[model samples]
Target chain A: MKYHLILRVVTRLLVGPILLYGLYVQFHGDFGPGGGFQAGVIFAVAFILYGIVFGLRDLRNRFPDRVIHQLFALGVLIYAGTGFVSVFLGANFLDYNVLAEKGYEGQHLGIIAVELGVGIAVFAVMLAIYYAFAARPPRIDDKDW
Target chain B: MELAITLFLFCAIVATAIAITTIRSLFAVVMLSGVISLLSALLFVLMDAVDVAFTEAAVGAGISTVLMLGTIALTSRTQKDIKRNNLIPLAVIILTGLVLIDGTLDMPSFGAPDSPAQTHVGAAYIARTADEIHIPNIVTAVLASYRGYDTLGEVTVVFTAGLGVVLLLGGMGARSRKRRQEEEG
Candidate 1:
């Protein structure tokens, strides 16, 4: 059998579901218990699992650091941009009531946008931290364990 | 039954902490810390703080555990037995714990209807969430609409922290490394 046969198989089987679950937590935060922070961590966990199994090189190949850099700023921009948009619409900063015709609709839109920003920002940070730590050469080897 | 479960969780958490302190293996200590976080998450659930519970489970137990493991990989797995004066630190910890426990005596009992937290802006948030925001989850409404500025600030901090880590540990790219090597040649 291949090395870490069970782990690799399980990780492959679970990555898709984990990503889906993360999406569910992200989009469903308005109605459910979780919000952006939790969803972002869950999303990053999927890649983390893949990286642990397949190796960091493969993970980096799939998700280039350049993309991570762009996303790191993009999330915050989306959040602040929502506020600026509301301000331009003649409402106060982050005042989502002016986002749509109805106050509630605008609030809903704003929450989703802001939460999306949170989710993206958190995901990038978590993955970036992971990469920083994991990229280092380990003092201990597999046989040492 | 709820109290029983809470008591069990608390006891288990204390036991995990003791185990963590006694254990020389850094790997086991990291795992024990994750256990403490997971137990704390359960306690949050019992207190009806589902959102807090979710965060504790995901970030505290899940992500932090992975990060700690990465740290262990970079460093030694065994903790050094540094025989030093820990009495002062232990005394300070006990004093801090006692002071915190004393402080809690003045606070309202768990889930009391008349507690300051539930009676003040929390009450208003609950009452107006359906009207002003119309979101089913009041927590989301409070976090995103009522407390949008706070969350925006938090996101900015996360972004800044990530940028710092990238600057500190992450080399820009392989291309730069290759260019440097070519220059050296």
Candidate 2:
């Protein structure tokens, strides 16, 4: 990793754009061909790329495993929370009609909320897997490959 | 042009798969598998399933390949020679392939408007998306608003899987790693 100056520079340059694109996929999912799942994986890729180049120690310092664990649970909470909120609003479970004054608006709000939950959950899980892999010392070194 | 592209993509995918099987280097195999995923993603896009294509590209080509490479790093770089008979496995694969091919014959052709999928609740969902969800993408409306419960379950599954992995492989912090290195020294 220390020897690959060009790789390090390129990764640094690419990480920002990759993260921005992940956000675009996350929020633009309703109108476009992406959603929470794709966005979350893309986000994880961006961070993983940075982590691979910069080192796991650096990445873990910036984003701890504990926080990702919380975010992972939070996403499920958000999705289920949306459903329960609907139930409390005198509607059926997972019903979006009662979320807002207008039915369409409520649906829109509900979709956004749920998608956000999906995104957070997917991203955290993906990152956590990466952590599990990187936590162990690699048997093979970069030069060997 | 579409048909030509599709043919090319399919050929590329088949070629990559063959290469992957023949390759002795585990790294090359991983890279080839990634190539297959990318080619299939292109095919998905050609079939007008951009969402599916996106997921395939990200998860199949991106994440899985990286994770596989990580596995290779954890284990060994080269595939060890095991003198085992491949006849039974090959026969089983062929039989399964034939059954799957036969099954596909009964299904509606791709993009058939009169197909059950299009004729069934698909129409209802489409009609309702514009009226109730006001969203341009019927997929999002169906996934998040219409079939929200299913998606909740999917997210919960993702969460559970993450929890399980972490529980099994916990203590991935810098402090633990540093302590391990110190112990090694």
Candidate 3:
């Protein structure tokens, strides 16, 4: 990893754009052809690329396993929380129509919140899985390939 | 031009699948799987399923490949040649493929206006999106609003999978810490 100067430099340049693109997909999902699922994967890819080029230690230090684990649950909580809030407001579970004064406005608000939750959960899960796999010691050496 | 592009992409996908099956090196297999995902993404784009294409490109071509490579790093690069009789499995696959094809024959043609999917709930979702949800993208409206429960369930599924993986592999982290402690001690 240390030897790949080009890779390091290229990854450094690409990570920012990749993350921004993920955000774009997450927010713009309602208008365009993307949502939490694609955005989350894209977000995880940026960090995973950084891990591949820099090192697992650096990545882990930047984003700890604890935070990843918390975010993992936080997303589902956000989704369920939105539904519960709706129920308290005299609407059916996950009924976004009552979220705001205007039905469409409420729908927009609900979708965005739920999508954010989905994005967070998916992103954390992908990264956590990658970390789990990469943290282990390889059974074979690099030269064996 | 569109048909030609679609045909080419399909051919590439088939070639990649064949290569994946025939290749012994796990690394090449992983890369080819990525290639197949990318090609399928292109097909999705061609079919105007951009959201699906994006997901396929991101998850299939990107994350899955990386995960598989990580798995290879932990395991071995070369695949083990298992000397086992494969005739039964091959026959099963062929029979399944034939049955699936036979099932498809009864289905309506691709994009048929009178198709059940086009006429049924799909039409209702499309018609209601503008006035009901006021979202431009019908797919998102359906996924996030109309089918909110389903999306919630999907997120829960992902959460569960992540939890399982962490629980299964949680010991690796502790084991490594112990190894480091021993090395230092």
Name the TM-score of candidate 1.
Answer: 0.94
In Å, residue B91's CA in model 1 sits off its true spot by 2.2
Reference contacts preserved by each model:
0.87, 0.88, 0.87
| 10 residues in a row with least lDDT, candidate 3 chain A | A136-145
How would you order the candidates by lDDT, starting with the best? Answer: 3, 1, 2
Q: How many steric clashes between backbone atoms does each model show?
A: 0, 0, 0
Candidate 2 structure quality by residue, lDDT tens digits, B1-185: 88888989999999889788768899899989998999999999999888999999999999999999998999998888888899999999999999999999999986689998888898998787787788898888888987888888888888888878777766456667678789999
Per-model DockQ? 0.81, 0.81, 0.79
Over 4 Å off, model 2: B171-185
Cα RMSD, each candidate: 2.1, 2.0, 2.0
lDDT of 2 by residue, A66-114 (tens): 8988898898889899889999999999998999999888988998889
**Recovered share of real interface contacts in candidate 2:** 0.88
Q: Could you tell me which residue pairs clash in candidate 1?
A: none
A1-145 in candidate 3: lDDT tens per residue?
8898999999999999999999999999999899988899999999999998999999998898889989989999999999999999999999989999999999999999999999999999998999898888788776776
Task: Give the per-residue Cα lDDT of candidate 3 at B5.
Answer: 89
lDDT over C-alpha atoms for residue B105 of model 1: 97
Root mean square deviation (Cα) for candidate 2: 2.0
